[model samples]
Target: MPRSIRRRPGLAAALALLAAAAPAATAQQVVIYRCTDASGALTVQNDEPCPAGSREERAIIEPPPPMPVYVPQAPAPAPVTSRATQAAAATTPAVPERPEAPAPARIADADRLPPPPIFRCHTPGNDRYISEDAEPKPRCVPLQTVGINGDPSLGAGAACEWQYDRCERIPDGEACDGWRQRGREIESTWRYARGDARAPLQDAFARVSTILSDTTCGLPPG
Candidate 1:
């Protein structure tokens, strides 16, 4: 049985260079020479350039990475001081230290987890919409339309009714699904949306983004 030989640093470095030059397709094999060193001691030598007789091919040993040679950095030069005038900074007799302006109040981002609830709402004519408000008050709607004569003034037919929009808190799962979906949609449309259309999307994106920042929302997975 051929034994694997652990060599010195010099040998290891040489082997590493030789292995690097070898074709990548070469099998992880190296020829090992068993012989006597110049000292005449029985030993397995790795530095031998060639085998004298029957050669043993052993698995190539991986060499450690080269150790970095560190040269100690020179100490910095000492700064020269001028003794021209060592007097205390000229003092203004009545000078008073100005009070530091109170630090500007820190505004916190809405990073609350399990985001605030979103509600689905609709006003009279089955016109549906979503809202964050729980109990929204009804609004007045003019029931009259333009007159046949184009006069537009409704003398006797003028009427109005209070429209109560229906609303319900959607499931958390459903709300979260919609929030993530809307975020993706907003990102998709970001390049195209312009002027008026972009403003509302910006607001909507802000709400969705708040949830996106929370890891518990399961977005952008850990």
Candidate 2:
């Protein structure tokens, strides 16, 4: 017996549409079967074959390829070349650039202020002290000797000259701290002094207070 070849054109088209809309997880292709009974009535169904003794046809429907997903790639690290190493890296692929981070704000030291000046003083008698006065008054010490020419109290004399002292600019932090300490000491003394002595204490306190409040000593600006 000769097998009748029949095809329902719409069935293949419909199955193809379904295959395209199918989930990507479905890896199997769509198979459509066409069937005809002995009475010559035609039927079409997916994934079903004709009954025994009936003519049949098969059609395959393939799903459309999935679109490729996009992903960002990081820049390649720089390679260093050496005289003893393998072939030196000549060139590398260009990579997408990233935004640069913002730089911190800054102000020059000269623009803001100069550090407070402090002097380290040493006296002839082995006494040491620090001075903040820009124009220090002349310090004079009397010449004294325990013995001269076998005399117990040989000679004593007075002389006047400006003492030499080492001066340096202190860091802003240290200067700020020094000014604060000085302010505290000035306030303590101001509370104890009275009448003529009160005037000098007030002046000293005001000077240190200004230094403390206005300078950052080398600290970054907020």
Candidate 3:
């Protein structure tokens, strides 16, 4: 017998066994339908036939597309510096720092003390010294230096007495007026005197007045 005729009975027997084993295959299958109603409203349904006045539209079953795969790109390479550029940077000179200023000189406390009174001797071998004592030395005339205490007449009592004697010798005239005028001028300048040296000037003016008074020279009006 031909091969087709011989396989017919076996194929029919296999189909019969499958139908018997799976009687509810049609009920288990899912079908989706798209339909339009009388009012032209479209509806989609699962496992239900279209209504009497509605038309059925074609439906299809499609496999879902594959999920996308994420690919990580390689990291960018680091920037490269040329040898010439690196050499230029290495050869650059750093700025020089400024020199600091020297500190100011400090003033000594001893330097601020008042100057000592100066004494001198007019004798050929006598040397000057700073002392307050004005006693006459042997063969030496004691003299107070000028501008030491702003009074040149200080420590010169002998000289002042000698001047007074000379004034006594002169008759009372323009000569006597000159001496009186000098005393008045000294007195006038003393009125405006100030500071620690002021007392010495005042004392000097008093000495001048006393000399004039002793010699009978006229005194200026107050």
Task: Report the Cα lDDT for residue 174, model 3.
Answer: 40
Candidate 3: residue 37 Cα off by (Å): 99
lDDT of 3 by residue, 149-205 (tens): 777755334322111111112232444454455555555556566576566756665
lDDT of 2 by residue, 1-222 (tens): 555555567667766677666656555677777788897777786777788887788989777666566788998988866855543334544342322222323555555564476544445556645458644566664444545575646655544555654444445446665565556666666666767887777777666655544445544555
Q: How well does each candidate superpose onto the true structure, as a TM-score?
A: 0.34, 0.34, 0.21
The residue pairs in collision within model 2 are 172-217, 172-218
Q: After superposition, how far is residue 128 of candidate 2 from its true place, in Å?
A: 5.4
User: How well does model 3 score by local distance difference test?
Assistant: 0.46
Candidates, ranked, TM-score: 2, 1, 3
Candidates sorted on lDDT, descending: 2, 1, 3
Is candidate 1 or 2 superior in lDDT?
Answer: 2
Model 3 RMSD in angstroms: 35.7
lDDT of each: 0.57, 0.60, 0.46
Cα lDDT tens digits for candidate 1, 1-222: 344444545556657766574544442444445544434433444645434443443334544444456789999997755554323333335342221222322334343357567677777677766666767887887876656776567445767788788888878867776556656666556546766876676666665666655534544444
Model 1 residue 208 CA deviation in Å: 2.5
